[model samples]
Target: MSSADQSHPSGNKPLGKRARQKIERPRAILAAALDEFMLKGFWAARVEDIAAKVGITKGTVYFYFDTKEKLFAETIRSFSPNLASESEPIDKNRPVREQLTTYLAVLYEAVAINPDAKRVFHLLISEGRHFPELLDQYFAEFLAPALDRITSLITSGIERGELKSTGLASSPEVLIGPAIVANLWGIVFADRHPRDIDAILTTSLDLFFRGLLE
Candidate 1:
């Protein structure tokens, strides 16, 4: 058999066009939904409009996600980081200051620098009251775990005499609040208030670590 024709390594054939389309249909729908949600808040967004963007019928969009609310939730989920899994594994041997700087850099990049994530944040702020369960899901699924990780990292640093034992360790949300604020600034001000996220992160970390380091 020709090398190109032989695909029996895993005893599975390449997916057919129809199969690939079926797999990708949901992702296309979700992307279109996010754009629609961003352009028009949740109340104004229409499933038909999202489906039109995806070149699919409204019923087809419904086939994958039954309701507009489910579609919006899933769209945010698709774009959001799986914080628990995505967090960089801390190197305990490294100085806590270095560890924190590296970790916070990643957090800031994800929350402040990413435009799509910022859009999702804006949507949540503006439209989340309409979907209380969606807000709860975001907190329970993403925010809670991320805060827990920060708290554990701080506690470890304190025990190792690397970080100061302060109220900040107990409330680790403060560590990431500035990143969220920067994200909000982007959403509210757009290009009018141009601030470099890298500079913001560097300065914020420097100030924060000065207070945190033992």
Candidate 2:
């Protein structure tokens, strides 16, 4: 062995190769699983297909994720970028409408702009009862925190005298109802009957501000 090669005891195996392998193997599996899950619904997706997608044998997949269910949960948790962050409180110093608009733009990109994102939500709405744990993970990762942010924004806007009480202020669902509608529309009809997402947001904002503002 050369002097550098002698420094590590793994013969011809490169240094850190094992560590890299450990990380890359699971990641490859997860990436493949995400694609499979997106293409195939959670219930219909197969581990063998995921393994094939990763170019690995079924045994290799089981070594990392004990069951297909665990693999699916891990894949959704890791690869679904929508749940990555808690919603940020709006900038109170700015106009509430402007702040809300900016926040919604970012949120819209994560939920509406990304085609794959709606599939995850569709899975949750349709199959959440079966995979309750994954549903809970989704709520914790995305929905709950985002709802909290909306509630906070509405409360702050009400306090600042910038908004009027429309009886929907207490409910985050009511406050951000348009997002849900937009996401659902995109999921169902965007391919054939494309709609202007920007226009939807703007019109929703206009109607919302009119109702909320004094």
Name the candidate that leads on TM-score.
1
Tens digit per residue, CA lDDT, model 1, 1-214: 6434444436698555676677679989988888999998888998999989988899999889988888998988888755565466667888877766677777777788887776777788898898888789888977787787677778878889888888988888888888988888887786798787777778888888888864
lDDT at residue 88 of model 1 (Cα atoms): 61
Give residue 139's error in model 2 in angstroms: 1.6
TM-score of each: 0.88, 0.80
* Cα lDDT tens digits for candidate 2, 154-213: 777778877776665567666456666787888789899989976887787778777777
Displacement of residue 99 (Cα, Å) in model 1 is 1.8
Cα lDDT of candidate 2 equals 0.73
RMSD of each: 3.6, 5.6
